[model samples]
Target: MAEEPAAPTGARSPSTRGTRRRGSARHRSYLRPEQPSGSPATSRAARRSARAGRRRRYAMEALAAFAGLLALVAFVGWWSEPARQEPPQPGGLPAVVGRPSLPGPVPTALAVPGLRPRERPPSPSPSAGPPSPAPVAVPTTLTVSQADIPDTVHLTETGRRDWMHWGLGGAGGTVRKRDGTGELRDLGGRGDRSGWDGNQELFRWRDGAPVKSVEATAEGVYVCGTGNGFQLAVAADGQPRTATVYLGVWMARGRLDLRSSDGGPSRTVRLEERHTSRSAQVTIRFQAPEGTRLLLSWTVEETFTPHCGNVGLQAVALR
Candidate 1:
């Protein structure tokens, strides 16, 4: 063909066509398989990895937006809420909700049963003088009667004879006597003396033993020995007169009688020996008119022996 395109310099000739074509065709096929496709031929594993990455990014962005919304809500609540206040303490002024305070002291009256409202007593007049003094009391005089004498008297016997001893032994025994001027003297062997000026005498029997007798002037008289008898006449003086007679006797066999000298009712007391050394006391009480006298008489009988018997008499007057 006009030298037909003069058969390009690098063109394959027909004679080597088979080998070159084969070689070149093999190379092109290998390179075509290695080149990227138009739409990528994704593998199953890579597609799954790409979808998971997109889901993770979306979750992160949504969480950040939720956190920002919570922060905004917290700020708005804090700015709108009211402030808090503390409660009042004890003994302090009470806090008022919406009111005023009460004033004044509390009243303390209580109702009582069966009691009327009390009225105050009237005050004394200003012109009234001081109250008069109360009157003093005077005690009245008291009079005693024979009934005041005690019904019982207690006494014990002293074995010694020094209290009063009568003259016995005929002439050598003790003699006790009171003269008209009230002077008493023991004139026998004993030589005793006293200044008692009253009429009294101690007598003795012919057998020399002292005999019992009434010594009218002595304050007290003692008698002893069995088969003895004596009488006493006592005078009373002063107005509203009363007298008490005391008789102390050995409780052997004896009888005692008391009667008014003017023949008033008589009272008698009797006793018999009991073989024991026991004593008795007798008290007599009676009213005696002024200038009157009382008669007391006693007798002792023979009973248990050593022939023991004893007695004493005393008279007292009250006005």
Candidate 2:
């Protein structure tokens, strides 16, 4: 062979291979820990380091989760809050203000017809249930006697549906002057009744404070008191005339007596009771004096029950 191919340079003898392996092992030994299988202390230290690393990783993950939760909470809070409005002008207080606003344009003029004269409606027929009898305003005249005077009188200035008439006080009832000229003075100072003897209260009449011999005429009588009540006697000195009387009171259980005392024998012409809560009118035709003296006396002895002020006598007019 061409001088046997130069000895192969890459090939190693068995001895050389053994020596190189030994040197590699020696270098590895130098770099390794003192304990071939690792000392107990070193092994324990490595395990602790591994555990610390895992714990640190877990801690970082937890921190990240907490941060994420905080961010989510912040987002939800921001979304749930009401939308912010523009800041108010300085010194301007927030207040609720409402005003009427036209939906569109307003009209400048209105089309209305001029008012015309009106005509009255026709009256109902008689066959139609007594024809709602035309609202005939029949002015009434009332004649009052001394015996017909009420014991109490109360009135109101207001009106009510439950009452027949309302005027000034509680009942709003009043007694107008018969002559249409005169004022309501006192009860003439007629006090309470003295006793059960009716006559004792009959002739008893007082004015303001003194008992005068004169007699005053009134358009109506109003009363308020207790006991034997009050009395009045109006009789003419000569001719026979009809005495028309009207009595009204809020309370009930009152009595009235109209009698003739002149030209004719003294006789009971008309008698009535239950004059309260009603308006009473009586007409008695009898003989009377022309310039006769009429007596009106009142008294209060006891009360069955305390009562509020009420309408006594409303009015009295000579027919």
Candidate 3:
């Protein structure tokens, strides 16, 4: 018998294929996420599972991207921040967390060291401008006066640059200050002198040269007649100094002249006793630059008697 050919499985007969399929057949299976349209039918659960898996994968990818973005942001902030280091401390003190280091101090201007010594001050030339004014006040000043001899002349033993006691030996003999600065000087005299041990007033000293201590002494040197005297000087050291001259006149007139070497004021004092012996003191105060001097002259101005009328110098205390 010529029977009709059997239709293949999953395929409809020619007459049934012409129109749309009925019932469950009309509902085709949902597409897989990776499959194209019109593919063979697959299980619904399998397609649904594939779609859910795709969704979960996409979510995971998004979450990973967000995590990467957060990491990048943290890196940028860390790079922009400043680096800090705290000094190490002993005894296990806690370190400061976020304190930044401070900058060093800045210099105001650049300068060369040790340039002042060779620099010379500007001054006007003699012809360029009127002469500069003389110093308003001299660096040194001096004053001299005569007075009656005091009964007790207190000798300054300490606190002196130098001290001297002259005529302690004899004529052409002298004594200087011990451990002194060598400032008191005898610059020689104008005439001959003789030793005399008959002076009225006596000198007492606790500090001496060779003779460290002496209660009282009345030995001296004398120069007779006018135009003859003792010339002395004291070196200046920028400090006030005093030279006390204990002198006597036997029937003679004495003149004391004192001046500063630096053009300071000069003073002269005179004392006279025509017939009897008279004693006096000449105190001189002066100041000058170091290495300069205070010039002093003690002379006999006139004589009452021609035999031995003279100026007698007992002792000189320089303190």
Candidate 4:
């Protein structure tokens, strides 16, 4: 080829020859790529796999975030609900009222659940009303005997303590049965300092453990109900044209007291054993103005033995 154009010196150099060969190989590799059969498909598949992997990762991250948010929302909702409360039961009764319904008959004690022992209510003032009729003279002076009257004694509001709801513990009692025997010995008050109570509305005594102490307070009367049968009788210095009455009947063991507005000695009401039975009856008699206000009470004393009693009012009628 015309002597190869005199074999250019620069091209004939070893380093230049090597460079040209390398360039040629590089050019051939770029142009034909040795006719690689599966290379393009493999590269395309790899790119697709990487893209799919990235998409899968994004989806998984999104799902994880969604699950976390859902759990957080559920927890928040559960924490925001209100708690439930229970209501009081039906048929429950209050602890205090004006007075019992009947006489001699054991009065009903106010019954309520969940009441605190120290929850004392203030006493109410006397009620204002018209003056009652005066006591009239009878044709003849008949000796009145202790008899079982079907009515119960009703205590006046003023008779109660300055802050006593029912006695001390929002309750009181009367003599159930007064057998001159030991049956009436156990005396206890549900309210009072003793704080003794029971399921029965009436105060009950264990066979040998009836209350042994009898005490009286401005709140009401407390008796052991078993001493030599209490002596319920008319006061010694009784006045004509006047009558006395007792209040409250249903209670544990205790006594009824007669207090004068003039601050005289109190006469203890007594229980009489009925001729028909061993049990006894409670009675109190005194002289008071037709509409005169009276104070009654049942207090717990600091004796070793316990005593219980009731508070109530008596009926006053002209002969």
Q: Indicate which candidate wins on TM-score.
A: 3
What is the C-alpha lDDT profile of model 2 across 184-251, one tens digit per residue?
Answer: 22233343311111111111112211212213222233445543444555434344344344444434
- How would you encode candidate 1's per-residue C-alpha lDDT over 1-319 as one tens digit per residue? 3554577779888868988888999989888855344445556557889989989999999999999899768656654554343356578966544232232266233324444423334544567678888654322222222222233211111111112232233222333221111111221211121222121322121211133333222234445566565565545332232333333445456666667655555677765545643234344445544445556565565445564454433332221
lDDT of each residue in 1-319, candidate 4, tens digit only = 3555566555577887899999999998899746375688888988999999999999999999999899778655655544333344467844333332223365333323443222234555689898999767322121222444332322222112110112333234332211222111123333432223321122212211123222322232323333311222222223432232322333333344545444544544443222211122333334543333233333222222233233232222221
Could you give the candidate ranking by TM-score, starting with the highest?
Answer: 3, 1, 2, 4
What is the C-alpha lDDT profile of model 3 across 50-107, one tens digit per residue?
A: 9999999999999999998997786567445654656655888776654433433874
Model 1 spans > 4 angstroms off: 1-227, 238-246, 310-319
Best by lDDT: 3
C-alpha lDDT of residue 25 in model 2: 99
Residue 285 lDDT in candidate 4: 36
**Comparing 3 and 4 on lDDT, the stronger one:** 3
Clashing pairs in 1: 169-208, 170-208, 181-197, 182-196, 182-197, 182-198, 183-196, 183-197
Compute the lDDT of residue 183 as modeled in candidate 3: 80
**For all candidates, what are the clash counts?**
8, 36, 0, 54
> For every model shown, what is its TM-score relative to the native structure?
0.28, 0.27, 0.54, 0.20
What's the lDDT for residue 270 in model 4?
A: 42
Candidate 4 residue spans exceeding 4 A from truth: 1-253, 263-266, 270-281, 285-287, 298-319
